[model samples]
Target: MSSESSKKRKPKVIRSDGAPAEGKRNRSDTEQEGKYYSEEAEVDLRDPGRDYELYKYTCQELQRLMAEIQDLKSRGGKDMAIEIEERRIQSCVHFMTLKKLNRLAHIRLKKGRDQTHEAKQKVDAYHLQLQNLLYEEGKYYSEEAEVDLRDPGRDYELYKYTCQELQRLMAEIQDLKSRGGKDMAIEIEERRIQSCVHFMTLKKLNRLAHIRLKKGRDQTHEAKQKVDAYHLQLQNLLYEVMHLQKEITKCLEFK
Candidate 1:
């Protein structure tokens, strides 16, 4: 009974390379596969022309194998032979797919290079135009300065313009305050707001000047009107005084 039991037990299967074969692959096969893939990757990176040739060769081989399989099918070829051809076709297809991916990567790399070159050119042109504009602006400011020094009247006009700007900036600030949603103090500290404390002071000074001028004009007009009214009253009073004196003289005669 013990011998029968022992005979019924299955023996461990071993592969020819001496490893247990129960679905276990040989280390050499795995290493060879890895080495092959690594070399292929290296070839793809180092020599694109070689990869292209491989792609072309695979395509031709695939076509020839397909034609041969069709011929064998029509001739009633063995099933094992047909299956072997099919597997070879599958490998060719997979390799061609990798080649196609590499080709697409190359195309995209070239396209990106073109776009970068175009962007660089645009940036250079923009910088050149900016430099020209800066030069013109400096020249204009220098000419204006020369004119200002030659003519002092321009200084007064400039002062007036500055006053106007101050007033306008103040009005804008006041509007912002009235609106009250924005944090004007923080914005000023951050330099996000255009006006500062110095401009606010100028605004106050400008307001005073504007008020003084308006008040003087109003007073002069009122003075002229007052003088005309006083002159009319004096004429009426003199006429009344003369008439009263005449009446008194008549009464004295009667007495």
Candidate 2:
């Protein structure tokens, strides 16, 4: 990324209320900024089938998160815990929003890239194959599902599925291993996770900043109104004092 764009990329410091945490970064601003989701580091669409599965999983995770967030909103509770939960939900939503955009972009960019009917057929076949595998295995989530990419290896189900997929791919495709197949798969997953994290962090911070800024504006407006009220009260008092002095002068003249 250019230095100019880098500077425009402000810090991500979000609180639970979708506001920026004071004097601190949200997430992406801390360490993993500019890792991925850049113009240069576009989404990889070489393996359309794999990308499609990942895209579907990303959508599913987003849906699940949104539902949870809605539920949390509806079931509002007291105090700090609720506040913390809100922040967590806001952050996740921000992250997933970015992920969804990128995944969609990848889908669009890869469109018609595979001109051949055979290539398209294979992609479709792989997609169907994955769906079948999940159904057969009784799994709702995929091996590639990025439920939460912020904490790597926490999505054990996804990691396990990925490892299994890697093993199978290695067995079936001999030439792929020469490119450090399993290791490459792991690396790609990590990078993919980081990319999502990086984007999510950015959006979270932006949203938080906007919320905080709006709050600041509101406070400023309230303060301005208070100042205006005080000024009006002082003017009224001064007017009364002038009237009393005039009456005193009239009384002295009459005497």
lDDT scores in order: 0.59, 0.57
TM-score (C-alpha, index-matched) for candidate 2: 0.30
lDDT of 2 at 151: 39
Taking the tens digit of each residue's C-alpha lDDT, what string does model 2 give over 1-255?
698999999899855887776788767675576564643233332343554466676667666666776676777776546665775776577576567667656554453233233344554576578788988899864322332233333434445555565555434433332243234545544443433333344444445445556767988999999999999999999999999999999999995
Clashing pairs in 2: 12-26, 13-26, 16-87
Please list the residue runs of candidate 2 whose C-alpha ends up more than 4 Å from where it truly belongs after superposition.
1-186
Candidate 1 local lDDT, 1-255, one digit each (tens): 999999999999855775465787878889888764344244224434444566677777767777766677777746658576776768677676766757655763564355445545665576568668978788433332343244345545755776676577667644543343325434322221233333433454455556555766888999999999999999999999999999999989995
In model 1, which residue pairs have backbone atoms overlapping below 3 Å?
none
Among these predicted structures, which one has the highest TM-score? Answer: 2
Q: If scored against the real structure, what TM-score would every candidate get? A: 0.28, 0.30
Q: At residue 232, what lDDT does model 2 achieve?
A: 100
